[model samples]
Target: MTLPIDPTALAGLVSRQIRTGERQGMPTKIAIAERTYATDPDDLWNALTDAGRIPRWFLPISGDLSVGGRYQLEGNAGGVVEECEPPKRFAVTWEMGPMISWLEVRLDPAAEGTTLELVHEAPVDPDMWKQFGPGAVGVGWDLGLMGLGLHLDSGAAVDPATALEFPTSPEGMMFVRTAATGWADAAIADGDDPALARPAAEATLAFYTVIPEEGTQS
Candidate 1:
């Protein structure tokens, strides 16, 4: 089944910025492209917190979702929920590490729909982040948001793996290519040398095999 939203538009919706590390010897900071969806805050909140709803777009997530509650995403890492305020904000530990990469999501009610904001914060590890990059996680979230939008609008059920495969399809490949370019732009904006950003972004896309073009971007 095809989705109503344009994959290219969804790929381009991300807005990102990078922050220099505060502490001496600390790694640089990484953030994702923030996206806002047109929907209701209450509906958005349910999409994020309800286990039954999560797997439709995102992974199979199992978590208490309450403040200080620990949670896990099947086949992925586990962490604790640091903050949870209904229909407003939710934050959680993303993976196992002292660095404590975290994800924060916020929802604001609007006349047209709910505006959703997502922030992923973590220390920079050139090698690691390059392997995953924003698209790795960002694409996943993009699929999740799409699924949520459909679920709220039409009672549709999306399989996480199938949604993820969207990027590998012909249309999905276009989205992935554009998203890679967008991330490269973000890397450049963050003060990364073009030399570094170019290679990293190419490598990242290659790692995910999302782009179906003849030659690798790198």
Candidate 2:
């Protein structure tokens, strides 16, 4: 299930940022990831907004996608589409269990291609943040962005089973470690203590690439 590309190079392609903000009057932590894809805005937009094309790179999604409509990703977050601007931007509520967060994706023309920016904002959980920093979710998005890049380059769907097994693969672990470290660096730039943030990044790496016993949870 190892990707055909250099995991380190692929992990380096993204830019990460950590922002402190307020959401619904509560303190929030925002993780932003940006990368440019080698495709025009129109083509990239279609690949993102088209339901039939979504599962090619990410999870299978179901539900309405228009403004105010609800959508669900299989075994993952489900939320309402809050805004939409074709070939430019879209926003949604990312809800899992009782926790609700905001996710927005923006696309713009870049010198090389179309730049995709993903912003995820959520109310901070002190213990969780202390244990994993932004990489808790940032690393997951990094993996998704990598999948998107592969799909764009190959013009084909990534193998679902392989993707599911990827995190435990040698190359997948390498990619996760690199991306997690990147998130830690971004957090440090945002005022997190370097000593603490580095450990959190290691925690995030373990969370993503660890394989659990057959009868126990991770």
Candidate 3:
């Protein structure tokens, strides 16, 4: 499928970061991704929070979205809205099965446009961290950010079929590979050994781009 933007250029749009931190005294790893959208803060905020608009770029979401309410992202994570500040920021608990994490999204008016920053912090699973680094979640958000950009630019929903097929496509593979490398670099900057981070990035790339055989799960 044809991508709405250049794969490499789209991959470069996000700024990635890794922060070593703690939540409730438990060691956690934070994955940060930021991008500037050529739209006003209000529009960007609406696109992010409006139920009708969410599936256009992100996922099908259903629930009461106000503070302390619950929300589920169809087949993905479900959580409670912890805080909400219109056209500015919001925080939520990101829970998938038994695992729980914290997600905060902030929108700031910038000279060029509105900058969207997503911060995802989860307790570290040492083995998973050693295997995938931040790219496990980072690359997925990279795709979401890419979809948002396309939706915002075209003022329309990104084709769901294309979005689903992207990761294993040649262009999608390139984007994932590039995003994984960027996350690895962020990990390295955050003091993870380069030797380990590089391999972890490769593992991340494989995880995202590998296609499963028919009737099998990925």
Candidate 4:
């Protein structure tokens, strides 16, 4: 199926930021992304948290799905459900292999539709952040949000294989480039050097869109 995505409109809908708050003993940076969905809060929340319906747009999810429960998104992060309140908000501990982070999603009614806010907080890893900036996580969410939009707009399931191949497609590359640039803008807004942020954004774009040479793999 053709990926029905509006890159320009989707780019306009996203807002990003790098927020700092104390986590353990020092300051931690959280990558925050927000966008509005035309659907209502109830519908949006169902699309997000309902395991049965998730694989249609996003990944297949298997989980206990309640406060203090555990969840796994196929081939993605698995985490503990830290908090949950239907149609409003949910918080979880994002655990991937040995790394841990915190994730919170909030939903609210908006003038045009519903506002969805996602916060991914992790202890500052200066080395990685310096090399990639927020685009690393921001672009991933951009894809997920775009998937949600397409699913809601068309009321159809996105073939999982197509979703996996999207980034390598021309339109998908354009979408990711726009998203990575948007993240760079957000980082600049938060006082990161434009010189640094722009390059980091480009690095992120390369990571997501470029195919490695066939002979490079050992």
Q: For this target, which candidate reaches the highest lDDT against the unseen true structure?
A: 3
- Model 3 misses residue 190 by how many Å? 0.4
Tens digits of per-residue lDDT, candidate 4, 91-156, equal 999888998889999999999899999998887778888999989888999889888877877878
Give a tens-digit lDDT track for model 2, residues 74-146.
9999999999999899999999999999999999999999999999999999999999999989999998998
Q: Model 1, which residues run further than 4 Å from truth?
A: 23-25, 96-99, 129-134, 210-218
lDDT of 1 by residue, 1-218 (tens): 46644768766666655555543556646565555656677777888889887776666878676788888888776799888889799888788545567787888776778777777766667776656555555555555556676666665677555665665677666666667667767767877677766776666566555444677542
TM for every model, in the order presented, reads 0.81, 0.97, 0.97, 0.93
RMSD of each: 4.5, 1.3, 1.2, 1.9
Question: Would you list the rank order by TM-score, best first?
Answer: 3, 2, 4, 1
Model 4 earns a TM-score of 0.93
Angstrom error at residue 79, model 1: 0.6
Clashing pairs in 1: 15-33, 39-113, 39-114
Task: Point out where model 2 deviates above 4 Å.
Answer: 215-218
lDDT on C-alpha atoms for all candidate structures: 0.67, 0.94, 0.94, 0.86
Candidate that beats the other on TM-score, 1 or 2, i.e. the better one = 2
Q: What 10-residue stretch in candidate 3 is worst by lDDT? A: 1-10
Better of 1 and 3 by TM-score: 3
Alpha-carbon deviation at 104 in model 1, angstroms: 1.1
